[model samples]
Target: MSSIDSQTTYLKYREYSDLLKVILYSSQSVLGAVPLIYHLKHNNQNIIFIQTGTMGGNVIHYLISNGPPSKKFIELKRLTGDYTFVDKIGTDGMSLYIPILELEKSNLDFP
Candidate 1:
């Protein structure tokens, strides 16, 4: 519990992929999806909103699944494995917006 963590609002992601699959990968692998779930589980999040604006499939999978996207979960799974926990990974064609402040906050184990 710290000042910045309290002032935080929503966790926004931009990459485009099956929200469900991405969430899964993010959870087990500590990818983009981990931040939101971590905040929620810790009661540190104010909102869990994707920044990509293109969402539908598994809007809440990050809190459900325990692994990354499966081959069946994606049409081109091979193209996404390398990007397992990255911004452009798994995305068909999307951008990533990682907040510098938020990212810095992730490294700090708040007391």
Candidate 2:
């Protein structure tokens, strides 16, 4: 693994269980998926990882994830309301939405 990978992989994940609320991955980054899964899992931080894009969820689940977060979630209920293609969005506001199939399967320890 590269130095960057090694660094993130070794961080304390349990501490981030409820703190790390967002993870927005772009298709451009090569080591964006499993490496993150390995890092998060290795540290014991079970997360409701919001995956987006065409191949984003596929990439992560294939690598470090034991399985996806559960599928029994309602889309925050309120977040489902209609909005323009580009509305209430900011640099850190939006994230890739994970499918219900993936979310419903994992036994995550979310807060």
Candidate 3:
């Protein structure tokens, strides 16, 4: 896993956290009855935000059964073919906070 400059990232994101919170909360309200913001935590030491999969299962259930199907979700469902190993993809539910410096080193083109 790539190490992140937590301080830099925190500083960059801190100014927008309130705006993000408002957008997220509003979206959650629109979603209605879905588990969206499942326990948000921030580490004072690292200044990194962490959100655990407390109600992730509920969210998945809501998305699969009740929520409006998105194009990506439909594609993912088709690719996984029964939701068996869907969780095994990528970091397997683990979130990675990569620094901008590290992202710049990659071949991916982003602004």
On a 0 to 100 scale, what is the lDDT of residue 66 in model 1?
30
Top-lDDT structure, candidate number: 1
How well does each candidate superpose onto the true structure, as a TM-score? 0.21, 0.21, 0.17
- Cα error, residue 76 of model 2, in Å, equals 3.4
Backbone clash pairs for candidate 1 read 13-51, 24-67, 25-68
What does candidate 3's lDDT look like per residue over 1-111, in tens digits?
123222112112342233234323433464432122111112212122212123222111100112211221111122222222121234433221111110112221111
lDDT of 2 by residue, 44-72 (tens): 53433432234222212222335334333
Candidate 1 or 2, higher lDDT? 1
- Model 2 earns a TM-score of 0.21
Where in model 3 is the C-alpha error above 4 Å?
Answer: 2-12, 16-29, 33-111
Clash number by candidate, in order: 3, 6, 0
- True-vs-predicted CA distance for residue 62, candidate 3, Å: 26
- lDDT tens per residue, model 1, 1-111: 665444433333433344434544554553345323222222343222322212331222222223332322222233343323333234454333222112213322222
Model 1 segments beyond 4 Å from truth?
A: 10-62, 71-105, 108-111
Q: Estimate the overall C-alpha local distance difference test score of candidate 2.
A: 0.29
The CA lDDT at 48 in model 3 is 21
